[model samples]
Target chain A: MPEFEPKIVAFCCRYCAYTAADLAGSMRLQYSPNIRVVEMPCSGTIEHGLILNAFEKGVDGVYIAGCNLGDCHFLKGNVRAIKRVAAVKKILDEIGLGGQRLEFFHIPASEGTKFAKVANEMTERIRQLGPSPLNKNAAGNAQKEGGQTV
Target chain B: MIVAQQKPISEIAQMISDCKKVLFLGCAGCVTVCLSGGEKETDVLASAIRIKRTLENNPLEATTFTCTRQCDPEYIAGIDNLVKDVDAIVSLACGVGVQYLAERFMDKWVVPAMDTKFAGGSVVHGLWEEKCGLCGECILHRTGGICPIIRCSKSILNGPCGGSQYGKCEINKDIDCAWQLIYDRMKALGKLDKLMEIQPLKDWSKSRDGGPRKSIREDVMIDE
Candidate 1:
């Protein structure tokens, strides 16, 4: 048997989180490779349906990284994203999907190290939670992908 | 406009638990303006149900159709073919739409997804408050546009009632006494003299007390 490695999908805003990801790469920062980043023009564009669809697609964890409060390129986009994230969290909780599986972070464009930290933290938390109940083959597949080490 | 709110997902899930295929009908009428039952709400509800059923291993097949207005026969007739294919239907319209759908498609199982609240308008982005009682009477002229029938906690006509104090009703401080509002408005309009004239007893025959009501326009009727 092999270890389980959770898949994570991160929606990053172009003005901040995306730039931080670029800086993290240029600075030779080491972060978990399990994260798959989707770039958005603004965090406000991230709708509640899109987050749920990602979970339905079998991702173990999902998060939205947007500009810090009052720092959004489009004035109040980050604030709107914050409220939307809260709404999605409540829906997730109602549908028996634990709300902890989704998260939102306010990150400035200068915080490359913080971006790397969030990736590692989310990876660790999801690893502890194991495979998502929505993913029936997730555990067996994770073992297969990790190779025979256990 | 009529206001409504969606039922809890657990109750809705239980209603169609036995069914494999279900159709979610959305209304583009009063429920749409109230933000309770519309195209967006229908999609959200369908997605939630799909996720719940998928997790339970039942894997429901849900489809959505939003009609122009469910209260009218013409709009409901447009979905005759789709309604024939589903085992059950979840209507996201006001109470009127739910009944209309059931009446039009006699054989299909139709259930309501929202609780018809009141005749009101939005006070803010997501909040709504009742403003009318639909008592089959029009007396806004005498009451200064504040409806004692609905807004008043006690529905006392020509009264401050013993419960009114400091412009608020005693039932709940958050609620303003309707008579007080009427009095203030009438004072501003220099119509305080109108309050001295006694109003006649209300005619209950015109209200719900008269039983189920209907409005007919014989001039617009077409012989079939």
Candidate 2:
């Protein structure tokens, strides 16, 4: 059997983690290639529905990278992100998806090394946890056709 | 406003486990203001249920719709087409919305996603506290704008009962003694003398004791 490689999604705030990812690339840092980075205006804008959407789409793990407390460029966006992450974590646990599959971290723009480190760490954690239970069957693929809005 | 909280995701999932497709209906009225049921919430619930069902290998097809207000028949009429194909409905409004959907779609299985809590206003961004008991009467003027009926531990007509201590109810230190609040307000307004009068027994018949009540405004009625 081929070694399991976990698929992860990272939601990064433009002013912080997103820039840090760019810097990591500039520095030639090698991190796990399993991640898909999504840049957002602010981490606070990340919604519970979006995180759940990722899980429903069959991602093995998801994480939100935001600015440090009191360091948010928008003043309180990072703070709001932290609270929202906590809320979604609880919701994930309430569903069969363990909250361990989701994470939130503070990564400032200057921390390229930290960004690479977190990327590898999250990838390793997910690898050990294996694929999310939602991905156990091929049915999960068909379920991703997404919900309709009426 | 009416306050409500969503039921646990597991409970909602269990309610519709027998079905393969469902509609998550949200209300834009009180439940939306209270953050329990709204468009955003409806989407989150749909996603969560889909993920849960997928894990169980049962899979699920979930759709979402948010109406202006679920309690009114006029707003519910908008979803007639949407409900035609779904196996079940999960209403995220207060209990009223759940019953409205049930009454409208007699053949479809309908369920509540929130537990209607009380008549209250938000005290903070995310915290809500009950303010009104819905006793079918209004006595705020006589009570100096504080409602002892709902705030008091015992709903005492005239009181700080013998249990009040440090302006807090004996039942729970966290609760303010409603009569004490009324007294303070009355004193500040120089209406303390009003509390000195012996109060009359409340007419219980005007409240829930009168059974389910209704109000009709003849001027607004459209004769059929």
lDDT of each: 0.88, 0.89
TM-score of 2: 0.94
Ten-residue region with minimum lDDT total, candidate 2 chain A: A141-150
Give the per-residue lDDT of model 2 (tens digit) for A1-150: 445667788999999999999999999998887788999999999999999988877788899999999999899999998899899999988876889899999999999999999999998898788778765432332233211110
State the lDDT of candidate 1 residue by residue for B1-224, as single tens digits: 99999999878989999999999999999988988889988878888888888878899899998999999999999999888889999999999999999998999889999999999988898899999988898788898888999999877786899999999999999999999999999999999998888889998778899999998999999999
Top-scoring candidate (TM-score): 2
Say which candidate scores most in DockQ: 2
Every candidate's chain B TM-score: 0.98, 0.98
Best by lDDT: 2
Checking candidate 2 for backbone clashes, the offending pairs are none
- Clash tally, candidates in order: 0, 0
Candidate 2 chain B weakest lDDT stretch, 10 residues: B197-206
Off by over 4 Å in 2: A136-150
